[model samples]
Target: MTTFTSFTFLLLPFVVFHVANAAIFDIRNNCPYTVWAGAVPGGGRQLNPGQSWSLNVPAGTKGARIWPRTKCNFDGSGRGRCETGDCNGRLQCQNYGMPPNTLAEYALNQFNNLDFFDISLVDGFNVPMEFSPTSGGCTRGIVCRADINGQCPNQLRAPGGCNNPCTVFKTDQYCCNSGSCGPTSFSKFFKDRCRDAYSYPKDDATSTFTCPGGTNYKVVFCP
Candidate 1:
């Protein structure tokens, strides 16, 4: 019993570290207008220009996406609407936003004890954005600052954003049928400009990136 107790004591620190291993995402808005930042499995906030909001995400959090909404009008009740990236007309979003919004996606503690992250245009594009792994073995942060809206393909242009082909067409060809399709001219259009983003269904080779778990990240708008 004495030996077992000593072994248990030795394992306590490892357990504590594993349980306490959390990733902090510091989201900043550098755009000229206010940004209603949204995250899943994480809450939402409004960040004015030069303002920053930080959220601590626990280790096991998965499939979390962060995006910014523009030109929002929220009353004292945190209920209102946004011009772009609005999430169910609520300020503190209880759900994901309607797309045509650039997405910064991450899943922590995935296979091989790594954290997978990417800037996904798969949802579409609203603002010039960036997602960087600020700490740990993540060096492939995506910076998608290209003016996709300014020069968006005429067919893919929306009011305040550029729509991805998948959103515009919604066909098996554009949506990829969950693994059995490929890119088209529209995906190539986004790929040619934003090389670090997901252009098509099978763009994981370059778009997806991984980091050692316990890494910290930052998502910036218009940066």
Candidate 2:
């Protein structure tokens, strides 16, 4: 009996390690229209209003992002372009999508066994989004629901989305290429609208959120 108890105790840490290294992402489209959802490691999916796609992401995944591609038209071979967030005209993205997109960025099981996440408008805003932890007792949720497209500045306005200043001007002020820049009027415009989102490259103080490792997450479009 004592030997069996010792074996169980030894197995417990392995189970915990496995659980801490994996997560399920529930991607949902609550918009009034259809959207092509894009993810770096998870590929892409077409989701109509109320539809959803679930993706299982492994632990230790870094620089992962999810976004919605608007006004997309893919053929039988899953090849097409999107008005925004187009990833090389492929339906299943092999890489990150183009800008004028609202981003849900995450790195799971990172420093101190925590999951770091944020909603970023640094690429620009194409859709309203809500990113939240659904499990692991994490109650923090970040959202970017402002009407950024309608209120986009003239220089940043695009056909179906708003462009970031960096995409427009490509200057160190907006792009932070020098890595020693601060907020500009353009970045402030986004920050004013979506206070909880990353307006520029260094908007980390209030924009970033953390959850316990292995926490499941939900990314809702038009939420």
Candidate 3:
């Protein structure tokens, strides 16, 4: 199969000192968004929709893919997922339809990047608002594909309760049940869930999310 490419150049200045191509998914006039899939040194910044940039993908990079950042919303408010057609509804945004063009192709076809290849999509074909990569453990973990396939079962706490880390989550059953990592009660649930299992601090806030099943499920702690 053809290689996938992406970039993360926004309104600000960005430079990738690697060997790869740049693709542009410019949605400025239409949706005010951009997606790049490559070895971007700096993660991302205030990216303008219409502006163009190059994705410097490393030659030997194992697996990589890129998508828009606005597709999924991780905020506790539940409004971040963008379900109702441009944040016009209450439900979480969903991704559907055919696959989007590779970042390299998108960039090269639209912009002036020549080091990339171009993959074709059906005419008037628009990808769903929320889609992600679950099969291939690509970069950023998820893409703009909407659907439960991408969202992990317990990685994110259900919308009903507050962003509590102790909630019974499948993504991090041990950490979720055992308040040892979170504020959950250190009772049987804790022992029953994560007793004798090794644990570690993923970050400074004591927030640690793990992957219990396939590499796809990202056990994230939403504080």
Candidate 4:
């Protein structure tokens, strides 16, 4: 609930550009329970077992986040709240999700015509998730859909999720607010399990990944 910018410390491996890029996302939830999937730019939807949602992200969208909310109850008007990953207490999130949630992050058509993408646990995690570039010549997929909840540290454990160090402790040591922070035992806990995701600030060098421009992505929940 603190004021933190998502993917603020991310540094694109490609150069900056003006031309826009477009892509489609197939967000599928394989979990038995229903998940309220939310996105900053792409909107929100509910996915039940064996169900999926799709969205076409227009060119020029940046810093987009796709995440799932748990323990949510919505009314007919899409007005409601969630126990985890709640975005301003709404079913359709035009905003960012709360902490203690797993995140799929991306920026399309960045510098040098490359698209940057990653699965981020820096916000903590409620559910396991995978982010994969489906097309545009990407061979690697990013996933953090690990059983972190069952093994979450006592201090970091929340009602339905694990809290990132920065969210739970809110200290310079974990937050890297002074831009001097590095990996700690907590971040190591995440990195050890999800090697490709960002465990903390300054994790760009190895955690961030790139694909060619115009690449489509698939975000799978409970994968």
Q: How much does each candidate deviate from the true structure in C-alpha RMSD?
A: 7.2, 7.6, 16.6, 5.0
* Reference-based TM-score, model 3: 0.23
Which residue runs of candidate 3 sit more than 4 Å off their true CA positions?
1-30, 33-42, 63-67, 70-168, 172-223
Each model's number of backbone clashes?
0, 0, 27, 2
Q: How high is each candidate's TM-score? A: 0.90, 0.92, 0.23, 0.90
- Candidate 2: what lDDT? 0.88
lDDT of 2 at 10: 33
lDDT of 1 by residue, 13-100 (tens): 6655864588999999999988889988676899999999989998857768899888789999989888888899888877888878
lDDT of 4 by residue, 91-186 (tens): 889899998899998877656556778888889999999899887578799887679999999999998999999998899999888888789999
Q: Weakest 10 consecutive residues, lDDT, candidate 1?
A: 1-10
Best by lDDT: 2
| Cα displacement (Å) at residue 116, model 2 | 0.5
Q: Each candidate: what lDDT?
A: 0.82, 0.88, 0.24, 0.84
Most TM-score-accurate candidate: 2
- Give candidate 4's TM-score: 0.90
Model 4 has a clash total of 2
lDDT of 3: 0.24
**Per-residue lDDT for 1-223 in model 3, tens only?**
1223434343222223322322222222123443221112213222344443333433323222232233433345444332111222212323321121112121121112222221111111122221111222432321222222223234332332111222233335323323334322322221222222111212112111111111221111110
